[model samples]
Target: MGWPPASAAAAAAILCLGLLASAWAASAAAAAHGPRALAAVQPQPTTHGGLGPRSRHHRHAYAAMMYMGTPRDYEFYVAVRVMMRSLAKLGADADRVLIASADVPSDWVRAMREEDGMRVVIVENLRNPYEGNLGGMNRRFKLTLNKLYAWSLVDYERVVMIDSDNIFLHNTDELFQCGQFCAVFINPCYFHTGLFVLQPSMEVFKSMLHDLEIGRDNSDGADQGFLVGCFPDLLDKPLFHPPENGTKLNGTYRLPLGYQMDASYYYLKLHWHVPCGPNSVITFPSAPWFKPWYWWSWPILPLGLSWHKQRWDDLGYAAEIPVVLIELLMYIAIIAITRLARPQMTKLCYNRRPEKQGALVQGLIKLAAILAMVAAYTIPFFIIPCTVHPIIGWSLYLFGVLAFSSAVINAFLLPPLAVLTAWLGMVGMLFVMAYPWYHDGIARILVVVAYAFCSAPFLWASLVRVIDSLQTMLERDPYFPRLSEPAQETEFSKLF
Candidate 1:
């Protein structure tokens, strides 16, 4: 009996080791077919656009954002203002341009136009087939179809696109001389979307749109993907060396890495010497815990203090304080409304007996199923000999157990919002895993796949409840409906 159990354990261990080995190999294999493949392409000159030092056409650098509303709205507004100021300080201020949706406030438009010297182009008529939150692997992305509109600005001979997060340290206007399409390598083989040069034309615009219509997929589900797809031959081009000693440009070239250094390099440089020094433009990529703007984020990144000062000096503390105060008030009001409405919504939507509607039981069942699936997937790994698997496998095994347990506990106790957050969090995790930077293979994919399928029912239920809760408030007047009476059941409620 002892021998049989030991043999079974040993068999399970072998199976898990094989799975892990395959996963590692799969991830490595995926890299070749992915962005790494794109990066590996050697730079080669294209026949489509002329490669010369000078063009008589006007060159413009553009920065754009979808100014929908709320707290982030002011942040980008300030960013554009500061970027313009930084450019002017460096004597590199070309004609500043902004691409915005129709919904942007008239006052903000006037500010950018009158105060900042920015030409605001409204993307009112532009329509894209894939313009929304694509909720699968691209859940974190908002359709960046708007960025493609820059190609429609025909007056400029070339447009160097800069993301709002980028901070220019010096005048790098020489970039205009690089090429028709130019960007620096970011991923192993792919270029970053943050900073790039494009020659604007109706032909390019139509071509991009056509590619979209034909269902061309971007690896990241954003503009970067489409651009990479459009210019598949980016890597082989000569690295863009800045024009030196009044020499004329030789050939099409990639922007040097110094043009778009990650702000994280700031930390590394402080502790140790690194190349790509005195970056031309430093970009602060997104992170949830901190940003270069927040006061708390300053200690680690004092260089951003100057950028903040520039914003204040350009916009004035008096002017800045009131705008921030108004934004804060707006945020508070939105939160207050949501808090006051939640109980009213719950009371109305669920027939005032949310607990009795099988929500808790269903959630519990789903949680249990997820936990069981995770356990089944993980238990075999523990049976493997102590040294067979990588430390990453052990770490992920622990993470799955903890994540499943938390979901189970929260499923019954917390509101649907918690469940929805959990589901979205898991989705976000999958995106992180899928990102080329993660450098993992089949094991991670298998773990995610197992968890996602097992948890799908719970995710669906949670989403339905959250949507129904919001819809209930939208349909009825809070005061007029009266607490004594509940609204009729929704079609969604019946299905859920």
Candidate 2:
């Protein structure tokens, strides 16, 4: 019995060595080929289906493009995640696909795949043939030609290519049953490319590439104009009505106006009144600055709240909170230090005699001071992240202004009220834009214009006051009190 037990132990040791050898070999291969090798062999969680070879059978996909050409790329990434998460929550029976540029960070791609349950297709940024011809075209559309990659996604039977600015109010799975190509006419003549259905075909994709290479008559040098050029006859096509039997249509068709309800429409009636077809999606095809994801767009465009709500419900602001909190803390520290150490900062000012400086030099100095105050107000606005929560965004902005304005006040010995007029005006302007009882967008715009007109004189008065105060301080017998002298506490220091 002892001999038999020893033999069994030897066999177990041999088996253990074999398993270790296999694991070591796999790890070595992964080390040699890098993360892609590991990604290939890694077993994905069952909730997120494996990225193995997809079935050749027809499938449907909801696709959007993410390219890194713009300053607001991160904001758009957040928007795309919210949109994809919304589609997943709506129980849409289609793959959520992101056509990302090759340069998109690996971690972002991994996060979208693992966290958002998205299939990412990495593609090269398509070159715009009309780059030189772009006279009045929006330069942001330079990489938009990459949208043509949608046609290269030949794995899907039907692909609904959508812009990130879209908020899905309802399931759009029925769009797959419409046709090989279908788009809504948000404008009278041109179809809106914000959301459009297309049947992916390599042959068609190649043809498009050929057309692009040959310098085909693309009006706007963007995907919208290029596609419009390709399908010029879409306006005349019959309207699409999804067949109850679920049969996919063959030809191009015009999707109902309701499919791409412009957000502007809701502002007109203060509610959705699109009776053309099912009001499934809302698109912000207006000015680029007014995209719904922006925190400032809320209340100005009431529909923006809906998009924010979706973002909150689906992809919470957890990722943004850390940065926002850090910024808040930094601003608070700046304000506190500036207030407590005002005397020390004031001592740093120049002490040149009034006779030494020429009139032109003094005038230039005052102008420079005014410009510095302007920079203090405007710089903070651009530095803050674009898509943070409105509460956090506005609060950070206010704190940032105060901190910078305080520094300006201490350095120049200017009156605080004159220096802070811009901050106060900004606050008042926000309230004006957010007034809820406006009859329509036009009324709201007119009211804002009128408010600006009314406030102009006051602003000018503040500017003049700032200049006069600066002139007085510069021409004083002693420009700033000597550091050797006893510190005299002024009203500014007392208030702080």
Q: lDDT of all predictions, in order shown?
A: 0.54, 0.75
Q: Per-residue lDDT of 1-496 in model 2, one digit per residue for the tens?
A: 1112333443344334333433443344233222221132222223121234663343999999987756566677888999999998899899988887766767778889889988887766777888876665455778898788888787788999999988888898999998889999988888989999999887898898899899999877788889999999999999999999999999999999888999888877666768779988989887889898887786677777778888888777775565565556655665665566555444443445446677887888788788768767875565455676676677777877887677678657888898888788888998898787877777888888998998888889888999888888666554244545555667664543
Q: 281-324, model 1: which lDDT tens digit per residue?
A: 87775562245544324333444455666665676544323323
lDDT of 1 at 156: 76
Which segments of candidate 2 are over 4 A away from where they belong? Answer: 1-52, 55-58, 135-139, 344-350, 479-496
Over 4 Å off, model 1: 1-58, 69-71, 125-140, 244-252, 271-278, 319-496
Candidate 1 structure, TM-score to reference: 0.51
Backbone clash total for model 1 is 11
Q: Highest TM-score: which candidate?
A: 2
Clashing pairs in 2: none
